[model samples]
Target: MSLNDIDNVVEAFVKGARVASKSGFDGVQLHAAHGYLIAQFISPKSNERTDGYSSRPENALRLLKRIVSAIRSVVSKDFVVGIKINCADYTDDHDRHALVLDHFRTIAAWGEVDFIEVSGGDYEKPDFLATQTRSPRQALFSHFSRTAMDAIESLKQESTLSAPLPLILLTGGLRTPELLHTALAARHAHLLGIGRTSILCPDLPRLLKEMEKETREVGTASSEAYWSSPFRPEPDLTFSPIIRNLVPTIPLVGAGIGTAWYVVTFRRLAAPPTSKGMSFEPDYNLGPLGAVFWMWIWVDTRPTSGMKVCRRRLSPIGIVTAAFHARWPKSPLCKTLMEYERQILGLKLEAGSLGLKETLAGREVYTHVGWLALVSGAGISASTTYIGIVRSGLPALIHERVTSTPADWNAFLTMVRDININDIREGAAELRAASQRERLMEERIQAMEVQCGIRAAPRDLYY
Candidate 1:
């Protein structure tokens, strides 16, 4: 994990590659894109050390150089050595925009590398690298790739002065045949990297080739003709790229209704006393149906009031609130709310109980939702109890949680619903009471400090 452990990391990779070659694979592409370990070191935002690896751009390239050198030493010269590199860093300081050309130029200089496939974005910028769904802004979606390609093209042109052209592979947002052909014709890109599209239409390349031949000999193919092709096989996969792309556009109520139905049906079938055991048979059949039903209702109802919030705001807080409810179902509603507030918002309601504090601080909200649902028995009957808990404690929770960071107040409200009856039985009253007691103690300490000139000292000071 530490960059200091480079020697061991390199040895392990080299060893793995040797094993793979021995097993008869053609070659290996060192996956350095998408903010992986190598990409992390190359990126300025992630690599902040004062050592040789962080001092300069060339230093950043050290790990990559070492890896290529090691691989070359073991593999045959004829064996392909390719790399998947990010075109640009989507994050602020790590923005690969300015230095991307230089980086490509440096990599191109390395004689050992045979091919370079370009990609973009880091973990922080999920939209650029991991966007699986469609948006109105199709051009913006491929921003990273576009930027990277521009840089690569500049490098390609410059390199021609000294030597032959470099083989550059372009990936991302290449869903259409026209776009691919245009890029190739313009000499901006040499190879097309098909990802999710290939998964959608595996034989797309073959189909496109046929389409190209038909167009050259006769004329442009009509849409009806394309769809009527008897040679086209039925897709074995149910989730097509089009469907996957459309999912994010599904309304919140639709998603919620789908979730609610599954919870209810599965809760009954997978009920603890079932003879069928806790298998997913019931879930599998009913879950998709529930999802479809919800999606349908979402489309029909077309309610815009509560469904417009982004997933990032909802998912994280929803998880934390769910966890709190599950963990402390028998606890006072106030305690559950306080736990959520502290965990997701980092607003400490109680000063003691390091376990609760640490758990709240470290655990993401969405993750806690399952724990809350499971322990609280809020699975199917979440609507009944969730409301009362929120009504009684939400004000304090919001006041505490949102003081420092402003979150979508509406999304926070939407996450809470009625708790299931089962959750009420599993409630943790003792823990809630303990948390309340801790809050009182802290309050008393603060009052004492103000009144009697008494103050708590840091543990480090005592040490």
Candidate 2:
């Protein structure tokens, strides 16, 4: 769905909650946690708008208020409304802690929200902040680091000043019974939101209670192995047949086809027309089928296509080729061409591999079907620039496989290594050439001046 469509759905959901409350539902908790839409809007880095939705700190709050207000219009005043916010997104700038706290302050004043659940991080950077998948690998003491404990303490302190909402649910890294009890004793959190642990051990609360009676300490409840034992491997759930059947085929089809077209169109718009005044109009010539084919080809053979149109000069044939190529390379396009090569070659390129460096340096030759063109035309010079700014900036686009899978991480490291080496090589060559030219000119000027002095030392100063 388009962004506007998502916005409409969110607004409708808020309105629906109010309607449900009016119909006798108890309350509604706006699900803003785990780096969902609301969380994206709340993040300073994510919401870069300078307009109504982007300006003042209050602008950020506006979307949340609209949702709440829509709910309030339909629901009774007695209904309980609350927000679950991330205290610190692991991926967000560390400096954004202030903004996060400020956002919470705004929510607290709303009077509609009855509670706030302070979690941390988005899905992409989910270590302990949003998910518990990595908890087993962590050192026992690693969970209670000063930063983690301090952030929790700060959230607790902030909630105290929050209007009337007396409840704060802290979720993230709070696995051990000892940690939970300590937090409870210190009044850091009211509800212990056990996400991964609960998933692993469904009856953890009961088990903890039973263990509490048997022992005075908290750690006696369960070992890491015990918690990990009950963990069921999560299965990949495909879209339901109903959804597959009901959703319009156009969007899926459009995305499949139009991605490259959109990129080429956007790139053409970004820059001045070439010397010939030739312009790109993907829809006009390519049509939907052509656009889809180009989009697919661009995705498949991103390495070859991504670099070709870096300057955004699209000939009629280029457009046709883009359409043809997109469809030609059919598997779900990896963001990078190196990824495609790795997949096809079935060779793991580890960090610092010379071959990996060669492949990445050669990436400029592999033109990004659509997005990369748009990115490069819009001023992304290199793949790293695209990754750092565009990919990292958008939570949805930031591929999390790098952290979730060791192989992905290794691939990323290799790519980065190659990019860095290429940059250094180019820079060093330029600097050396420039230095040699400067030295040669200096020697020539010195020789000429010496010859002039030898020819004429008898010039009259006053004359």
Candidate 3:
């Protein structure tokens, strides 16, 4: 991008904050982790530009520093603005780790940042999902959060800061109450970030508190802290036992099962919060396959759930099909597309019905459109919000397969220079770069673990 374009690049982030402030959001968290654009400018493995922002070690954070400054000026002084940053960039090189620390220290030392969330993982080196086991484990980035906090303290003393210490929020792999207390007790985390586990139990905080009370009342305090199972099976649902036995080892299918489990639960959750009619109890019997179908059916039949997805997706063909019995003569390709989808899914067209949805003896014909997005590379459509749920709701992952951007930076610059839509091209290209970096970082991390005579621990990203 040109020098003129670079100015807008920084301003755009500030503009986003400005818009968010106007939109009545109390705050905005600037994302600078996961090998994204802000991170690309910070990481040595990726940034090779000769510009002032990427030239020197101190200059590595120049762009984001400017963004933070611009945003602070644009938003209301008390408007909460935080940044989510990595503890490290995933390679085993200690020098790079030091550089990563330096970049984070710069951000933490700033008075403008209200809080800094510590998380580690770039697209190439992501360990996004921590272990799903019932056993307790430290959240993945606790050490880094501790280290970052310690460094920030040293910086405060060295610089003789007048501002208060920025808060630290740690994300990834937080589950049990014991684990929660441990991190806070260490003084590393000022706040906890509950990701997937919260989905399984919507009122997880309350559940943990109740479990703690029950254990203490029984004088079971001598034993390791044990929370009651977050999962519960329904009386009519016998599927949980079969699913538990069937596929506990498969992560992809397991992730799908876990995600599907939550989406099905969220349907009941969408019920009015004031009303006590809905229960949080989940059907353990519904495996990933069963869960996907349940989600599709719920969203389609229920207007509230369906509107978010169908508004963007339901094609011209589907509209005519839903409202009319005759074939849509104007759009034969639309008919052909649905026909192909049904054939691939092994389903006959429902007579006088546009959707694949049907019920025969309590069995529903469900199509996995979002899963097919990954498989057929068709991108996200149908139950797209649930797709957002399944794939970590980060925007890059949702519409990932749809965009085309050069993997290499030079090609990216060429496209950017030629287009007025620099932001779109830049975002797509940076996402590709992030993916490449993640793969490289993962390999490096494993090799380093082997050299140190330690097994690569599950969900442990920082070495």
Candidate 4:
């Protein structure tokens, strides 16, 4: 962001906080996680400015600091103010987990903040937030959160107490009672947060509290017992592990795919099961085929033909090729993806073909928050941007993947368009384009400034 816009951005935070504070909300958590504007300023890969905002580590935090101060000034001291931050950038060479912790330490120590929630990864590499696998590694970000909590704890002990020391909230794969209880018992997190599991089982909070009560009574119920309570959601049951493990061809990654899955889950949980034979839970209803198509639409990357576009800093080989020299289709990696989808999902696809209008027509309006819903295949073809490539782009890109046979491909694309699959694509396309347009205008301004000998480069007074 431009320096001139700093005050305006800070004003937005303060104003929003005041509104929330007056609206009877308990507190407001500054969303500094998952590649938001605050996350961008904190991330080294995105923040390249040479001004005071980016000159040093503390300077990089100037925007957040100003906003925090402004929010505190407007709201009463008792009104809680918190911040959620990513532990890592997850991009190559931009590994700044330690730096983020130190920055977090400084903020928590200043005592302006009430609580700190630690999350990691953004759309560029969102696996930190949502892993590709059903049973992903647990507490991937605990080390960072633990370190921050320890630092803040020391600061509280070293200094005189004003308010209680800030509590740490850790989110990421803390689904099971065992994981949640273990983390809290070990002081890895003062509060435990669950994500997809909560969507799968909305009563997770009550169940957990009840389970805690039960455990206190029995005193010997193991992790196995906690899951076997029957009220506990089998969150991992959502995906066909064999199929989900494939494609994106990488191990334990793919944020776009994960978001898409959660979106589908959120939609299912939002409504009752269909009266028809079709189950709201796609995984249970469609089986392996459903999972394959899930990956196919959300995470799968295809080979590019002819000329290449320079979207990223590295070679324009695309994500798949950048990892493997050959095309994803020909490569042995994720070989099971298409095979399973064609065999299994093909049946579901054919069923839709018969009653496409009746089945999917009303559901287009299902997702209230479009991106999180993965509505119209959002994040399906993301490259330059973290969010999916929008509804139209999904079909456009999928058209390339299914084009091995011209007749089959043309027929499929026709069916896709007929079903209004790209309903949300227009909005996604506009949002994705706005950033690129801004970048283009900035580049053009820089070139003109150089020609005019105004300076070696244009300054970030573009607020």
Each candidate: what lDDT? 0.52, 0.49, 0.58, 0.58
lDDT of 2 at 371: 33
Instruction: Quote the positional error of residue 368 for candidate 4 in Å.
Output: 50
Q: How close is candidate 4 to the true structure, as a TM-score?
A: 0.52
**Local distance difference test, candidate 3:** 0.58
Model 1 has a clash total of: 19
Give a tens-digit lDDT track for model 1, residues 1-463: 4565988778767766665565467778887867888888887768887777782666978888899889879776666778887665633456445676677767776667777876655555543333223332234434544454566556555534553334677665565666666557765566777754554354676878887677667645564354334332211213456655666644443334434544334333322444544332333344444544542343112222323322232222443444445555664543443444334222122242111311233332222222244335323333332222233333343334322322455755444334443443333443477468766565444433333322345322211
Error of 2 at 282 (Å): 52
lDDT of 3 at 273: 45
Q: Between the candidate structures 1 and 4, which one is better when assessed by TM-score?
A: 4
**What is the lDDT ranking, best to worst?**
3, 4, 1, 2
Candidate 1, which ten residues in sequence have the lowest lDDT sum? Answer: 352-361
lDDT per residue for candidate 3 within 1-463, as digits (tens), equals 5667769888678667766776579999988877888877777778888878773686878888888999898666889989887665643677766766776677777788888888766656445443443322234477777777787777766656767777888876566666677778988678778765666677776877777777777765543646433233221322467766875554455444455556666655644444466546555556557666765554234343312234322323443343322233343333444444434222111111122333323434323332233334334334431222222212353235323334575654554464345556665686677667655554444333323333332331210
RMSD of 1: 24.9
Candidate 4 Cα lDDT to native: 0.58
- lDDT for model 1, please: 0.52
Of models 2 and 3, which has the larger lDDT? 3
Candidate 2: RMSD to truth: 31.8
Q: Score every model by TM-score.
A: 0.45, 0.39, 0.56, 0.52
